[model samples]
Target: MARLVARRGRWFIILPPLLFLFVFFLIPFAFALKISFGEAALRIPPFTDLFGRGADGHLHWQASLANYRYLLTDDVYVVAVLYSLRTAFFATLMCLMVGYPMAYAMARATKSTQNILMMVIILPFWTSFLLRVYALESIIRDNGLLNAVLLQLGLIDHPLRMMHTTFAIYLGIVYSYLPFMVLPLYATLEKLDRTLLEAASDLGGRPWRAFFDVTLPLSMPGVIAGSMLVFIPAIGEYVIPALLGGPDNLMIGRVLWDEFFGNHDWPVASAVAIAFLVLLAGPIAIHQYYQVRQVEY
Candidate 1:
């Protein structure tokens, strides 16, 4: 009786998140899946029902695979998907490169200094995300802070055309997602065993050599965690690319938006979303596999 009560109590703790996921994520996914097979219609909601009563007064169920087929036929979608992937990959790499050193430094700092550094890393979250993006736009735009500084310093004769470019998109992503990369890395590095390093040094390993052989290897979990944190959202990012990137920057997110709103093609848009979800599952699955292996080890 006690064990049963304890198990039920544990389930009560797990129930909220499970219900939230079911309502928000799974239910929406199911609806999108249903809509993906639907035919586009001129009527409101703009898609035919998967199942409906026919004029003959009989129940009829139907589905169209046209949207899925259309995705395969469309070069624009293929390019957008590839572009989003490439952009996210490079952004995540940049975050890792920049964040790793910062995380390492934070880990090695004195406890009082660590507190200050942590507060600095986390301070960005206090502002609205949209506001921060716009702030970045102001910094990088033509006649903005960067160009004004350069001009005043006599470093350039012209205002740099920094906005509406691929570089700006990359910069925006790195700036926004840098904290995500840093926090995870700092968490892992702060908990790292200092004795391992001391032993490595005692065995005649140089500081750089010990870091490469010991610190870097052990921090792989945090590296993977931080990469996934940045990569997943960055790939699907619509706002950064739309605001900071050129018209040529047709990322998958923008493609989906254009399909749904600009073209009013919900079926094709849903198909694109479903396909993107499946594609993203690859990375998530790999992450899960490694996570399980890490736990087992």
Candidate 2:
């Protein structure tokens, strides 16, 4: 009786979040799936019904794989998917490159300095995210602060075309997502045992060699965690590309937005979203597989 009560109590604890996910995520996903299988319509809901009443009052069901078929056959969507993946991968690499150093510095700092550094890193979150992106836009624009300062310093006779380019998009992504990368790395590095480095040094290993031999391997979890944090959201980023990038930047997020709002093709938009979700699942599944293998080993 006591065991039964305990199990029931555990289930009660789990029930709220389960219900929340069902209500928010699962239900919306089901709707999207339904829409993905639907055809574009001229009417109110903007998609043809999957099920309808026939003239004879019998129930009729209709579903098409046309949208998925179109995705496979269309080159534009394929290109967009590739572009999004490429952009996200590069952005994640940039974030890692920049954040790893910052996190290492923070981890090496004294306790009070570490707290101050962490606060500085997190201070951006207090302001509006949109406002920050807009601020970046202002700084990177042709006649903006960056060019103005460069011109004032006599570094260049003409303003560089820094804005509305892939470089700007990358910069925005790295800036926005740098904190995600830093925090995870900091968490991992802070708990790292300093004695390992000392032991490596005792064996006559240089600082760089010791880092590669001891520190890097131990911090793999943080590297993976931070990469995922930056990569996943960067893959679906719409705003930065839209605002900071040019017409040449045909990312999947922008394509999805244009399909839904620009073309008013909800069915196609849903199909794009579904396909993107499938693409995202590959990385997550690989991560899970590796995690399970590590646990077993």
Candidate 3:
């Protein structure tokens, strides 16, 4: 009777959220998938075509693979994909570099210190992301605070060209996503046993060896989780690049936006979005498999 009651209580708690997700998230995703497979041109009718032409001259309902072919063969799309991948990869790397050590330090700190550190890390999130990026622009632009400081200190004769460049984009991404990486890493690190390090030391392992064998192995899940959190959003980000990136710095997200809004080609935009999903699905599947294996082991 107690077990039955417990199960019923759990079901009550789970059902509401599940229903909400089914209504909002899953339904939208399904609709988007259907629309992507159809002729979803933004014409006068403003309707979707599944398999037949309407009054308009456009192919209303034709199923075609030309969109996918274009995505695969188009040099511009390929370059954009490569650019996005490279940017996300390096941004994730930079986040890991900046976040891991901070997480470690926070994990080892006193309770009060840890609380303060966590607040400091999270406080930036209270402000709007766009505002923060704009603030970054002010700091990095010519005649910005950085240039003013350098000039005041006689470090340089002229202000540096830091805005509207790859460096600015990288810096913006790393700054924005650093807290995501640090928080997860800190959670894992906080749970780690200090005695494990002592045990390794007692067994003749050097500090580096102890870290490699004990700390790093145990922290792989956190590292992977943090990397994914940082990388995935960075890959699809449109605003930061639009604000900070140069004309030559083309990302896939920008291309997709241009197709949909600028050129009014919903079919091509949907195809590009689906193509991104296809490219990212492999990595995501592998990551999920690894996550499941981690749970199993």
Top candidate (lDDT) = 1
lDDT of each: 0.93, 0.92, 0.86
Order the numbered candidates by lDDT, best leading.
Answer: 1, 2, 3
* Residue 215 alpha-carbon offset, candidate 3, angstroms: 1.4
Q: How well is each residue in 184-288 modelled by candidate 1, as lDDT tens digits? A: 999999999999999999999999999999999999889998999899899999999988899998899999999988999999999999999999998888778
Query: What is the overall TM-score of model 3 with all chains considered together?
Result: 0.87
Q: On residues 195-229, what C-alpha lDDT tens digit does candidate 2 reach at each position?
A: 99999999999999999989999998889988988
Name the TM-score of candidate 1.
0.93
**Regions of model 2 farther than 4 Å from truth:** 1-7, 286-297
Per-residue lDDT for 160 in model 3? 85
Better of 1 and 2 by lDDT: 1
lDDT of 3 by residue, 168-265 (tens): 88999998888899998998999999999999999999999998999988987789888998898899889889888888788888999898888776
By summed lDDT, the worst window of 10 consecutive residues in model 3 runs over 39-48
What are the models' TM-scores?
0.93, 0.93, 0.87
RMSD of 3: 3.5
